[model samples]
Target: MMWPFDRCRINENDLFKHDWRSRSKVQVPQYIFLKWTLAFLVGLLTGLIATFINLVIENIAGYKFLAVFHFIENERYLIGLAYFTGANLILTAFAAVLCVCFAPTAAGPGIPEIKAYLNGIDIPNMFGATTLIVKIFGSIGAVAAGLDLGKEGPLVHIGSCIAALVGQGGPDNYRIKWRCLCYFNNDRDRRDIITCGASSGVCAAFRAPVGGVLFSLEEVATWWRSALLWRTFFSTAVVVVVLRAFIEICNSGKCGLFGTGGLIMFDVSDVIVTYHATDIIPVIIIGILGGFLRSLYNYFLHKVLRLYSLINQKGRMHKLLLSLTVSLFTSVCQYCLPFLAKCQPFDPSTTEACPANGWSGNFKQFNCAKGYYNDLATLLLTSNDDAVRNIFSSNTPKEFQPVSLLIFFALYCILGLFTFSIAVPSGLFLPIILIGSAYGRLLGVFMGSYTNIDHGLYAVLGAASLMAGSMRMTVSLCIIFLELTNNLLLLPITMLVLLITKTVGDSFNPSVYEIILHLKGLPFLDANPEPWMRNLTVGELAESRITSVTLCGVEKVSLIVDVLKNHSQWVPYCR
Candidate 1:
């Protein structure tokens, strides 16, 4: 204070003191712009990677199935069956080995782990590079082996890993020159990035951007802020755009991946269900059935997973042997079922009159003489998505008889449940959707026999109801189905089914993902605690305490108001 510069230093210190109101307002815009830009880049990368993985899985699975089909066409039944069995065994074993030996965290649907991580739980190597690679390849192998799994679940994990890497500046070993992305390296920003990436993954998987945003909000994230909403929406939009462009480019060169137009596309032109006042009875029935099925599925699925865990604890070899045994059993069933069912050749008259369409010609031989799949081998061996599409098609009843549909429903329910928690990377969505479609079509056929209703409509309703019940999701699933079929007219019915399904499901148990989290021992806090907790008294609970505060008189009220005016964190509780 004795020196002249000391007074100037004190003034400078006072001027630079921490003050929220006096901070530069321009930096806020810059920070938001940079953060959003980083999110956009993360979404772009996630979409491109997801598209690549889907294409790869489709091609590999298609080639393997076609190889077996070719052998069957040449009358080499035993060889084809052997090849199919061997292919499934080898692929599943390889995928399992990769997951077990390299990245154990990559196995199963990774949504639970991701959910736990987003809730501030630290999981070792859960989002590492090894997991990303193993998940991508292992999921591809599992799907190619004709296992009842979908790539959608693993894609979320993959997207999170990518975002984590991008946020961390492209891994520790490599250097990333992008300085803008460094802004998101902090913990808070990285969580937002991961959320955006997860949303992007769903967008790529379902080709539904809005549905993706809703899914992340409803199913995945544990903590959400209002500011993150638009960021996730923007990310989903970017992902969808990138994915669509990639699909367009790929379609221009090839005939088209998966037919029916784009990836994950469904036909919705033949829906004829006009909801009447009396139809609520049947809709409610469907919802109840869906809920019961979901509960049953969860119970049995948990038991199977327990058995697998016990077997896994014995030794790694035991797990591999189990994989081989399951593969062999599945192969025998696939081989024998087709011949056991009634055989019908394609009608010569129809074949002669048909135009030379490449797309139709490819799947023409797969159809029987009655314009439907009569052989068991064809029905079981065909792609899951294709089977679901056929179930929802207008000609479903003509193509699949009532008895055959029932048989399929029974067989797939068992296979899908058992195949879900295998050692390899697997998913529940596609299999569950297929099962739900079969259930719906069977009911729809029976109803159409008496009433003037479309079986396709029933199929749609059944699918939505079952999925909603199993996943315990409502709005997102409805939007996803609407986007999948590009049909706005089905929204009301979809909403109704989903609402009923979720209500019934909640009455029984939590969702599949929540169950998995509990089994894994993750510290996930439930938003809605169990009803039994209300019985406990505060005095009986340990570490419970009460804080006392003194009340201010009327004369001190002005001082409190003044404090609230100056302090942003303080508010007038009375108001």
Candidate 2:
């Protein structure tokens, strides 16, 4: 198949046509300065974007939870349910409208498109200015509405958008013309900058700068160089600086529960991981089960997204309707399902408060007795970020009942299935982690009699396993998980789980992003080639058509263009 807008290998003539270093107006030193400046700007803008999404989600979700809790506590169940569902509907509908009316490409987890771009395929409107705006606001609405979406994927898109704009000397429509930015207008320079942007994305999202660089190299970018490595590292360093500054600035509880946890989003450093060799039985089980479940998740997600695409192809209104319907369904499940959970009696002797009533806590007092905390309520009542923290919190093995976790995991599994690809900026990262964490907690609770290790460690490993199973990432995921949890002691098991799950998942099907790319029919190429590709030589494709052309001789531009037209773009030098 002919790849649209194909960028074939650069021949010697391209040096005179496009090389930045040889340009009369562009000095190498000045160009380097501009590149670094743009990298800093990309990181700064991406970090600010992440901060904006987090602050908005926390404030809106917190107030909604508090208001619903007040009504529920006062025995106004119908009013509470009405308010909850209405809030979700409105928020989700706003995001749906943004994606449907403003920019349809802003919908869904955008990692697949980003992967395509970094792999040298250019998809239209994938990183446009309008898409950036829609994704920024749409992500807020989707997550704040309590849908099973994450902001990391959209943030990555936003970073790439900013980088693309910078590569073009700002938005073309705005008509900002600067000679310094002209050096990056070429495809090669732009791709490199976008790679830095991709790394900055993960850096800001997880506060893991190193993982960001590794993620760009391992998962996204097909081309790599030592210079690009330094640029990507610099970009992520800037992101951490900006994110850290904001975290410090927002530490006084002014931003409505945004940066309370500091750089480590989930701080389990105090957990004291003490797993015996025999304790690895649970980790192995978790890896196998998490891999199976998440692979199944990818399969179902593909089917659901395909069905949504068909329904959405009819009109934009169908998109809005689907989102609203899912919002209502999620609201019902999140609100009513807690009643089925059996309350666990709170221990007064613990240092932390029982039935805590702040924005987030391990114990939730939802219509339970004064001395007891409802487990399901704790999982469903708070924001996803807080839910992750509470789940991964240390010494909380019995915090949630097995039945409560089972129901919670099952509810979200279905919720995530429908919530993705519904005309909103969604992501799979946190949603997968949440499901896996709960499943891990369930395993920990079930096997409590056999192991002495903290169940929180299992939850962490389970999260890594599910992520690896779905995404098929190795080193980068290992680092990101460690940075997110801040428990380096579990690195060995984390690596083991990731390797086992990734192998298990890959044995069945491609990664989720690959599935998305295949379904969308984007003509992208992966960095890793299959075994058959090794035996086939590039020259064989052009052998039949270019038999008369000389292999090494000067040729006119017209003759070269004519030869290119006859042969496929995938063909290398003709003989």
* Top candidate when judged by TM-score against the true structure: 2
> Could you give me the TM-score of model 2 versus the true structure?
0.92
- Residue 474 shift from truth in candidate 1, angstroms: 0.5
Q: Model 1: runs farther than 4 Å from truth?
A: 1-30, 175-182, 255-261, 264-275, 344-378, 528-575
Off by over 4 Å in 2: 1-3, 6-11, 14-26, 257-259, 262-265, 533-573
Weakest lDDT window of 10 consecutive positions for candidate 2: 1-10
Report the lDDT tens digits of candidate 1 across residue range 445-551: 76664544467778888888888888899989999888877768778878888998889888888888887887777777566778988788655653544343333
RMSD of 1: 10.0
Worst 10 residues of 1 by lDDT: 1-10
Per-model TM-score on C-alpha atoms: 0.83, 0.92
Q: Candidate 1, after superposition: displacement of residue 112 in Å? A: 0.8
Residue-level lDDT of model 2, residues 1-575, one tens digit each, is 34455352334486546664455654877888888898888888888887777888888988888899889788899999999999999999999999999898899878788778767677878888899899999999999999987888887787888888877866558947876666665677888888888888888778999999999988888888899999899999998998888777788666765635544244556666888899878788888887788888999989997998899989988888899999999899889999898878997776667795556777899988788898888889788888887788777667788888889889888988888888899988888889888888888888867988788877887788889999999999999877776777878889889988987898788898888888888767655688988888656645454454454477788887887677553435453
